[model samples]
Target: MYINTVSHYLPSEVIGNEYFTNINNLSHEWIVERTGISERRKASAEENTSTMAIKAVESLLESIPYSKNEIDLIIGATYTPYDTIVTLAHAVQHQLQIPDIPVVSISSACSSLLNAIEIVEGYFALGKASKALVVVSDHNTAYYNEMDTVSGHLWGDGASALLISKERQTDSDMHIKKIITGGAATSGKAIEAVVLRPNDRGVIMPFGRDVFQNACVYMPKVSQQVLHACGLSIDDLDYLIPHQANHRISLNVINTLGIPVEKLISNIQYLGNTGCAGCAIALSENKEKFKKGENIVITVFGGGYSYGAMLITI
Candidate 1:
């Protein structure tokens, strides 16, 4: 599988650390020191996960120029879907007027993008799809309380779309080398540590310590496993893209892997943690910065106690 184009859409509303500081009674410097997020985007009232994803897909289609009839598969990844009855993938298909293509939705939290990529690759391998559109979006503001100092302040709303094809479209296109995904259920109790309950008072309550500890361990472990499977090492990686859950979590994973901080591609400072859209958006935003044939590793850990990694060649 090859990536033909990548694009993203972010809402107009920008929320800064100052907004959180005033609401949470904490200094802006304190928030920055802990999360390294200065600002994040929030979707407007009219925007939802599906709409954001459709906008991203439109941008991608503009670049790739693939007709609706050419697309064989559509995969949407999101944990914050606007409606459970109609999947985000189906909504995107409806908006794009994509004809009768199989639409699948994934709810793997932060790891959903990578997981979606793997699913598309499987379809390609089976000769089931020649062209695939993978879209991911999340509206964290919809679930979290604005006044909550911890989880609420850490999320942003964004969507990303990637055009993947069985054959490379151009010499500049990037190849999907290896994608590995897995997680341990031993930490199943940690599920409640980072949860967004419907009836609960608009708060995405998270146990800070538990999440931090698990992220620090699982992220590096899965990253190493994927790298080894691809017969690559940390030194061979030209760029490392980890799920932008928190600044500290990213730093810990880099430190544990002993990879240089400069090699890690991080957008948390501006985009915050956009859940499933984090890694995909970061990849799209940094696409031009990558050189051909360079190795890029994406490692992610999410709320299901889920973790995985993918190795790509640019």
Candidate 2:
């Protein structure tokens, strides 16, 4: 179970913190200090979750055009789907012209893609599916509250897709060294960390304190466990990518763990928070940073109040 190819699509609209000052009492400095967000990209009217999924899958297909028929499963991991009845998997399958493959949608928030990785790991191990496509996308601004300054400045619109494939003879061309991939919930935690109620027009309600605590405790611990499972240590990883929820959270985790700042792929400064697509987009956005044979650790705490971590040898 290895990631053979990857692609991502970001929205066209860019909104800076200044736009919020007029609507709320928050200033650019306050937002950056609290959540470490300067700007976030919002989806335009032309873009939907389906359209964004197609954009990423199109790029993914180009790199493996002849292998389309080999794919048997398509997983669309998104918290923001355009339609309830029609799964988002159909959008990628239809655009890519692969009608026979099973298409399904899953929503686990930021950890959805990592959970997808675990799903494919079993699919390959159990001889259920040879090849799978995992795509994570969301359009939060359409439903996000403008006044909820903490969360509003943190989320962005983006979609990322990855092709998981198996090697014919265990060649070095592709590799996936799965270290720990999933973790149980921390005790006494709420079922939902963040929620929005449209009926009352409430802000993107989130227990930021709880989210921050979860990331700090679970993320690094899982990262270490994954590395140990891989017969490696934290210092051995060349790149570490976490859910770009906030710069402060990322920095706090790595710094507290004493992992070098250069070894981390901190993208919260630019991408804001992309929910399930955040870590995937970071990997896609920084693929070049990974040298062949370099180890990487990806950890995420998603909206399910669920968390997952993985160690892969690139």
**How accurate locally, in lDDT, is each candidate?**
0.86, 0.77
| Residue 66 alpha-carbon offset, candidate 1, angstroms | 3.7
Pairs in steric clash, model 2:
none
Give per-model TM-scores: 0.96, 0.93
Q: List candidate 1 stretches off by more than 4 Å.
A: none
Residue by residue across 149-192, what tens digits does model 1's lDDT show? 77778889999999899998888888888888876557845677
Give the best candidate by lDDT: 1
List the lowest-lDDT window of 10 residues for candidate 1.
197-206
Evaluated against the true structure, the overall lDDT of model 1 is 0.86
